[model samples]
Target: MLVFQLLGGDLRGALGPGWEARIADPLLREDIALAAAIDPQQRSLDARSLAARLRGLEPRRAARRQAREQALQARLQAWRRRRELRRRRLGAGLTAVLGVALLATGAMYLKTEQRRQQAETATAQREAMLAFVTGDILGQADPYDSRSSGAAGGGIRAAVDRAAARVDARLHGDPLAAAAVHGMLGNIYFAQDAHDRAITHLEKARTYALASGAGDPAGLVQVETTLCDVHRIGGHLAQAEEACASALEHARRAGPGARHLATLKLGQLRSEQGRHQESRQLLQPLLEQDTLGTDPRLRGELHWALGLSARALGDYVAAREHFGQLLQVAKAMGEDSSWLGWAYNSLGSVLVETGEYERADALLQRAHEVFARTQGEEQIETQMPDAWRAEIRLLRGQWDEASAILQRIRQAWQDRLPPEHAQQQRIAASLAWADAMAGRTEQARAALAAVPRRNDPAQARARSSAWRTLRWSRVALALDELERAGELLDLFEEELAQELPDPHPLRGETRCLRSEWARRRGDAALAVEGAAACRDSLARYYAPGDPRLQHLEATRAAFAAAP
Candidate 1:
């Protein structure tokens, strides 16, 4: 029987604090004492015998005893009721007090958070003011000396970290502040080639900016724009587009000039999404606008993008001219620009395409030094210069150096960028070429197989480009797969027939692959004929010392000297 008194549980802790006094009232204590003194030795008087004795002697005495017993019973019941009421009141009062205390704690926490945000906002304003002034001073200083801050190699990073700590301490609870902090952190992470970390921070900034309310429209747009860039770099096309759309909306709401940056970002997003026509349409008008009214760095960047887009669309002559203009602008502005390396790298790429390998190598090498000195060994996207340098090494037949550079690029891309990114695919393909040259056929094939074959047309094009240059040609030659090599040659010929007219850019490449295939099959006559075809194409399309022509010459010479 689970009687309340015999229950195996403590009541004091359940009642919270101050339960002892209510349990120990005088009347309550007396009730407990009387219960404790319920003795077997004490007898209950027999009322019938008392009544009988009272009838003969003292009936009034029996009545008096009965009245005393009734009074005792009433007193015991009253004490028990008061004790139960006091216990109930104590419980209710304690619960109410604790609830109030919790509410007070929550209010204090919110107030502290608000104060912290205010302090952070004040600090950020101060830092922005300082940066503006310092940047102005640096602008006026000698261009080369402006880069030599007291912090030197790691100093800029150290300062950024210090500022980040301040932001964290003050703005951790403020959504807008956190968003700004996230964007700043993402910039540093991106420079360090820590794309995963950059993505994390950019995502945080995006979420926070969306929820940061209607406070600062410009700040919100900036965060969103930065997130869009991160998504593009990380190869999250859909997410990048979504972020750009939101940023555009914010820009529209913020009135004039705000949309300039949003427009630029939208153009970038469009370009990545393969909406090249739209991208060009969006950016061309802005580029035509007076350069004096816009940010010089942004102007340079826009020009660089236009040049790249032109190259992608196969206007190499126009791309070279556009890059030249961008390069001059960056050089003239000098310290006022952050796009110096970009200009150089883009110029170098166009030069390489135009068969100016020596100039391309020199420009790309300079760009590589600038990036390495400024951003360290990270920043893989910004390391286009380094990739070009490796390409140059491959062209020069510096097998060991090319192989090492390609290995580093593959590792960095796999570690930092999404595995399916076009840049990553291209790097893997290049590394596969290096492996093929180094006589690691199994490794080369493994690398080639890992390149994804998605249904997206742009991805298909990119894969095809990498496949033709890296796998199809090299693999067929190494494996002596003449039939497959002929099939690939026919496929390329068919593609060019649709995509372009006669004298296609890849004609030399196609002929070279076929020549290698014929040579591997021990058909000297067919090898010489294919090599001659490639030589003729190369002579028409490329410079005198182009590596493809040299390789073709070597192949022809070998065949002629054969016994």
Candidate 2:
């Protein structure tokens, strides 16, 4: 009955009130007789006694039922507490998982957006750089178009200045575009012969190009090669050689065309440095290449360099051939009048050196006319031919005529060039020579003094010193200062030996002077031997029956007939 109550049993409710009367009728008669015999109190039982007993049992059952109800309520409370705790744990875990997922998604979205923005920014920068460079290129004058007028009536220089500023402002953030702009500006400056400015910008261009990954190797090579040219023109030979070597290294990796350009520049550099044999060796291979002949400008430059090297080496025949080729190329191009004039002047100079005075005079005159018409009279090109004409006059013993021509050239060069410029110094040396030839000893000394001394280590300075010493010796000889003349001659010979090869024309000229000095000293045997050697050298180098050869022959004859 207790287990049934605990399980919320209905066993007591299923027993009806008649269930006790039926159980008493079957076996109660025998059990009651036995209980009455054992205890006489069972016979005296009444309805009041049974009522009291039932009432007492009812209280106990009520108390038991109350305790069971309390236990069930306690179990129900415990089950509800466990269910709530499980629900709270599940909710907390779900919230944590959701928060982490949201954070990861937000971070990924932010990163993607940042990348997209950066890409867009890069695209904008590239487009802006392209527009800037294109605008600059279009605004500038055509480099090859000689007839094209200056920009906005301010001249090409003004236009370049404006374009340069714009490039700096618009392309500052884009290194590659900035390099290209700088290279273009450098080229313009180079064409104008503003060597310092050209070098500055070209170096900047090269620096930026390297920093920008050197995407265009050919462009870098061009920049370096132009730097080499600027340094060479400015007489900074060591810097020029460094630039040329760098350009050659880049050109070799770039392609054949770039390599060819670098090779030609190196040959020109070697020639300027007085390494004629090396220059010829470097340029000889280019002449045989079909690619070299295809580009007229390159072909002309190669021929010009070869001609100079050959002339320096005293190979007059080879020099003349190369100059002729250059002239032909210049004519075939017919683009720049300056090129044609330069070709004529170079060929004429070679002819003058070989003692073909008549032909040289004709060629030089033609060059003078061409330059005067093309580059104007005040230009350096126009003035150089006059110097060559003065040389011819001096060679013919027209000392006054040569001196007058040199005076005009000197004045013109002074007005246009720097005081210590190489061309000006050379003109000064020529003036001194002409004055000495005309027997103006004091004036020759004064003119030589006016020629500035070059402390710079350059081939030009060496040549200047040699020429100055030669002129000083001539003046000393005219004054009959034999000891001073001998000293000057010795210095001249030393400089010549250092600066020029044994077969150089200037060496032969030095021998002729030594012969004259020997004759004046009354050493007849020494004078005859010197004169004979000088004549042989002149005959071997100069054209047959040339005026210089005849002069040497006359000197030899005079020495033989003297006592």
Candidate 3:
């Protein structure tokens, strides 16, 4: 309003009637007052010039207008810069997230592709294994083939022998399948008691499985378990221990079934190594589990190992029960007669320990016949029952017959057993016992002296150790070396106290020997007491026909009081 009036050249109207009261801006009021005081006469003219300048060329008003516009423009530019910066940052963030997503997708794609390829490869390997097993391993035999000459009947053993040669040719591209086949063949050979062949194939399987990316830890467990067992039976204690430890290490990473088998195998190896107490300790936990798993063969083998451990520890009742369980398992399997025969022999061996000689004889005879008919005499399986029969004769002092049987099987045992093997040591002791009975004292001492002590000190308290010690005592008695005989018998008595129950066959035998020792020392009352104790404790269990039983009866009758 003031500017409009000033442009109209009416300063009084622009400033209003009371100009000082109307103009509120102090700087404007002061400017107007100063203009009026400069020259009142020219105030009107100056006001007119100011009004003209306000209408056209006012420098203060133009400067104020330019400063306000520049401030507003600067504010607008700052807002635009902030918005642009936010957009650029958002674009960069989005780019990074998208790149991360793409990388994740790529990784997922690669993992899926890898699994698919592995599955396909496994399928190919399984298929190739099937073809090789069917065509190369289990095919109908060729009569014209060279295996007909020496492998006897061109049997499964012969087929395996032939297939082993062609494994690299048939499954050369798939070492995993080759490992599987070799493992299978090794187990078969192990079953057949062919340790050399079994070891050859099992070692090859181990090599291939480790190198060929064998995905199944269970396969490694199986190969290692069998290899461990083969070395155990072959009397390679150190190798057996290493293989068993490896089996257990692999088993820890595998499923429960594999772990169970490996653990059981290690327990069995302990039994073979004369760590009977250790074996029982290792195996007892597996039986404590809620379930023993679904494999009948595994259950059967568990019983077998438990029986061995129990028998080694001189728990004859438990051993008999376990062997009975093994028999039931073998019966359930029906067609596995080899296992049936083994079960029979095992039970018979325990029966012998318990003085059930008649029953033991029957079982041993049956097992020997079966093994002789099926597996042949060269097999340790056949030799096992045969050796037991020899032991029975040796117990009865049928030295000639017993010595002949021992000589027959000695070569077979030596062929497979290492020089210092436990079995070899036992057989050598038995041979010395035969020499003792024949009055060849120096020869007996020489033979017994050649036998090395068991590798494990714990075995010094074992059932096998007791049996060896008993033989040494008997040899001393036969030589009339009463002092040596008394010392050895004292050791045998201590071992029997720890290992055998009352009325055990071995205990009864030791008692009879003690009675004879007393008789030789001219102690009639003590001899009568020992003879009566042996006769009373063993009368019901021993076979009526057993020579030891007859001998004990005669000795007791000789010491009886006159009527």
Candidate 4:
């Protein structure tokens, strides 16, 4: 306000002092102002005339500029309204997106937490199971305890039973743990050859492992593998086969190790079922690929199973190689004499089949000595050597010696074997052959009938089955039942045709029997042909100095010279 006052407020034409010179004619003054406001057109014109004309042009120009400004203002308001609406829509979309993101994040967090809690609970349950087994079961093995002292077999079984009794209460709601515990117990009983108890516990274990809501693939595979082994040993072959196949199916999902283990066990079962070629199909790959891996025990078991298949297929060289590998593995592992005894016994059986009698007898004697020392004289293993010794006697044509040995072991076999077993059938067949040789015609017939005939060609072509049929045919020939002998030979030939190679020792044995049948039928030419075939087949397997070779030569000469 002071500055405004000091500047002579509103002083542009104030007329303060000497106002007379600044004053002009009223009309002239108006004309001069109009001259300044308007562009200086017609400067010489009178100021009154210019003012009158300028006033007339100003209204029209102002009206036109006003109309243009109003139109531009209306366009700006329309654009502003559209921008506002777009901003609101973008804001709403962003809000919805943020809401969805928040919901997804919350759901993810809940899922992660739930899985973490479940894993922790499973871990705790497993730890609890380990503690229970270690503390509750194994800790009960105290000799000083009254219960341990009184219970059978130092209370190992009693302790297992006690632990099993508490499993429902202690490990409730944890079916996986229960399955593991029962599977372990069943394996324990299986190791001890307690088939009935093993079956009960294993079935229970499988039930828990295959439970609908709590199925455990690893547990299922392991339980089935063990059940296959136990069932096969207990002579329940069909059940064994079913269990083995199921184990393999589950093991495929489990892993390669599980698959290989299951396969090896199944191969052993197939061998027992007398499906020798099928057994080889499953087992030979394990040998060729070396898939049993670095576990000596598993490899050794595979070798033994392969040997069985090879021998049954009449591949003596392959059988020897497999058994030889088994013995080397067993010896390298520093296995007990019992395991060595089994290996030696396996190789010995092959030696017998190939007509290496001296080597076979030596190996069998070593096997017998080992069995006597490690297993004692009364054990089933002790009887294995005795059975093979009878085979040796029969091979040497000492029927009386073979008969005496078989008779001595009959009670032992009766004690150990089930009502129907391959080993039992083998024994019965051997006894029948020996009895037939001794001229006990009626006794041989009854003994031969007592041994069940294998119907499947896969079963009939096996080593034991072939030998049984050979015995049967020989008995028929001795009784002058040429027709029956011919039929038996035909069956044998059909079985061998399906599986055995041309140069197999089984082929040699087949030829020998055919020659005998042809000689009896007075078909001299066929007898000569069969004798020559026997010589060709047997030469590969039998030692040059073997009595069987010399016998084969004599037989060939006799057939060729027949009238």
lDDT of 1 by residue, 1-563 (tens): 00111110111111212222323223223333333334635423243543243233223434655797699789979967985786687886577675776699789879978766655553443333223223322223343332323243334333443444454455556766566656656665554555566677777766776776755576677777877887887787888889899989999876566788888889877766655567788888887775324455566668777787777555678788778878876775552233557778998987777668788989888787666655555557446777777878777777679878877777766666666776776667666777777788888767645443333455454424423443445655554545655655665666523443245456666777777777777877877788878877667667777776777778778777877
lDDT of 4 by residue, 402-442 (tens): 99999888887676677467777777778878888889889
What ranking of all candidate models by TM-score puts the best one first? 4, 2, 3, 1
By summed lDDT, the worst window of 10 consecutive residues in model 3 runs over: 4-13
Please identify model 2 stretches exceeding 4 Å from their true place: 1-153, 415-421, 449-476, 479-481, 491-495, 498-504, 543-545, 557-563
lDDT (CA) per prediction: 0.62, 0.68, 0.70, 0.71
- Where does candidate 1 stray beyond 4 Å? 1-178, 212-214, 273-278, 291-293, 332-338, 378-383, 411-414, 451-472, 482-504, 507-540, 550-563
Clash statistics: count for each candidate: 1, 0, 0, 0
- For each candidate in turn, the TM-score is 0.60, 0.68, 0.65, 0.69
Can you give the lDDT of residue 210 in candidate 2?
81
Count steric clashes of candidate 3: 0
State the displacement of the C-alpha of residue 486, model 1, in Å, after optimal TM-score superposition.
Answer: 6.0
Query: What is the lDDT, from 0 to 100, of the residue 477 in candidate 1?
Result: 56
Rank all candidate structures by their lDDT, best first, as comma-separated numbers.
4, 3, 2, 1
